[model samples]
Target: MHDLIEALLLGIIEGITEFLPISSTGHLLIAERWLGHRSDLFNIAIQAGAILAVVLIYRERLWQLAMAFLRPGHAAAMADARVYGQPPREYAYRLAAAFGVTAVLGVLVKKLGFELPTEVAPIAWALLAGAVWMVLAEQLAARRAAVLGERAAITWTVAILVGVAQVVAGVFPGTSRSAATIFVALLAGTTSRAAATEFAFLVGIPTMFAAAAYELVDVVGSGEAAHEDWSALGVAFVASAITAFAAVKWLLRYIQTHRFTVFAVYRAVLGLALLALVPAAD
Candidate 1:
């Protein structure tokens, strides 16, 4: 019963933080330190719930993209089929370009045995650094007077830049993936905040899904899948999916009319607090 409760709590945390410009992995690690360690599979598997939320929210657009990709002579007809003020093919191509870079770089990072510590200290520092980057990137975006670009405006270069940012976020636990990719897109000249946010998340669905799939395969292959608490995982997964859906919805609306200064401030303060409190708790 205690384990189930703990799983529910962590699920809530994962769902709420996963889509926000906050570090979900960092929060999960901190939560685990208090509640007791869980299987790495559990940690990764819960992300599928978050991905499912995204898919549900963007079902229409995803379907359009799929149809565009499958249409007869799509490569030659992309100039005609526009959906949501942009060609669906454009979104498909950009998403693939961005995810390709992330996928390749992520594999290389793992193959190279390059990993950052998931301890609170590293997370704290990353949070502080990401906060500063957010503030600066917002300021830079404001100065450009180029706030007209949408996801349709994401060029190959912008996609690559966002992909690199995703890779960096993967390496550093405190550097939130949404935060990193959005800011990188902004700095790369994605003029509108909504555009940057949408593209970041759209690309995130595949990246996260791939990661979860990889972890799940590893767990089953290692024969550790049998030892997992399936009941607790199911509860957590459902909790995370529901919360993530709400969180992402709120963020989408929030970005349309507001800046990300609030999240930046929160990250900065939280990072500082964690840095101070972690050692004492230990």
Candidate 2:
């Protein structure tokens, strides 16, 4: 019962933080300090749940993109192409580019045996740095929006940089992947907040699912799956999916009228508090 409760709490945390410009991994790491450490497979399983929520939310958009290939001359497809300054197929190509970069770099990093640091101090520092980066990046993006009047086009440069940002976020536990990719898109001249957010989320869907699959394979190969609590994991997976659906829905609506500075402020406060508390715990 206790384990189930902890799983539920962790799932909620993962779901709420996953889509926001707040680091989900950071929150999970902090929660583990009290809830007891979880297995890598468990973490990956909950993350897959969050990814599933995004997949469900974007089903309509995904369906349109898929249909664009089947019916290239369709009126709706052409209209979407004009709005995005590219055909749906081209947009998908860009997404593929971003994913390709991440896949190659991520594999290389894994081959190099680089692992995420589990220490609180490094995570705290990363959180603080990411807050500062968000402020500066948003200001730059806002200025570009003012001049360009917002753009939905995803440039090749933006695609590549967003890919690199994903790797950076992976290397730094406290740097949110969505935050990194969205801001990188904005800074690379994709001025529309909605566009940048959509691209980031779309790119994340595949990246995260692939990552979860890789981790699951690793855990299974290492025989760690035998020790996992399947019932608790199931509860956590369901909880994560439901909560993530709500969280991402709210975020999509919220960004239409608000900037992400509020999240940066929250990160700054939490990061500072964690840093201060770390010394006492030591």
Candidate 3:
């Protein structure tokens, strides 16, 4: 009963911030530190709840890909499809391309990062960096009015940029997944609303699934009470899913009219507070 309650609390926080310009991982990191929950596995697995939200919301688009993929030549044709006439193959190709780069770089980082056990990844820097990027995003949006268009507006460079940013974001929390990737989209000249939100959803499918899997495996490997805690994890996942569903709906509409300035302010304040609260042990 107690663990169930604790998991729900964490899940609420995760679902709300997962897709927002705010960093879900950052909030989760803080929540775990302060909330007295010692289970990294639970934290990680609940992210799947949020991932499911995106997968379902984009089910139609994803379904299109599923059908196209079972057939051959889908990937090649997608790469050459028109902007206005983009089909599932296009989305699949872009995801594949982005994932390819992300996989190569992410693997190297993980391999090298594991070797350096004493290092901290500067998560605070990630948040502060996000603040700067958000501010710049406002300027970019003002300068351009790029729309989502009939199809995804991602080019090869834009896809690469988003993927690379995710790698950096993977380096630290508080650096929001959406914030970093959106900035790249903005720089690649995507309009604010279109670039910030949808592409965030786009790349998130794989990232969150991978994270959820990693956590689950760890929990099982640790011989923790993960099986016993399935009930608790379920509660947490449902709570997070409900919260995320609402947050995503609200955010898509919010970004349509509002600016990223509000989130930037929040990130700035949160960044400074973390820096002040937890100085080095030295």
In order of appearance, the predictions have TM-scores of 0.94, 0.96, 0.83
Candidate whose lDDT is highest: 2
Q: Which candidate is the best by TM-score?
A: 2
User: What is the per-residue lDDT of model 1 for residues 1-282, given as tens digits with 9 covering 90 to 100?
Assistant: 999999999899999999899899888888888988889778876788899999999897787788887873663465546643567787689899999999999999989998657578889988999899999999988776355434337777888998899999989998999999998888787777887788899999999999888878888899998899999999899999999999999999998889999999999999999999978856
All-Cα superposition RMSD per candidate: 2.4, 1.5, 4.3
**Candidate 2 minimal-lDDT segment of 10 residues:** 75-84
Question: Residue-wise lDDT of candidate 3 within 1-282, one digit each (tens)?
Answer: 777778789889988998888888778767766566546666665787888877877776666566677854654465533322445566567767776677777878877854311112355566777888889776765666644332236667777878888877777767787888877776675554554467657777886677567667767788885445777778888888888888888887887777789988888888877777665511
- The true-versus-predicted C-alpha distance at residue 276 of model 3, in Å, is 3.5
Candidate 2 has an lDDT of 0.91
> At residue 136, what lDDT does model 3 achieve?
79
lDDT of each: 0.86, 0.91, 0.71
The candidate with the higher TM-score, 2 or 3, is 2
Candidate 3 residues lying further than 4 Å off, grouped into runs, are 71-85, 114-122, 144-152, 225-228, 279-282
Clashes of each: 0, 0, 0
- TM-score of decoy 1: 0.94
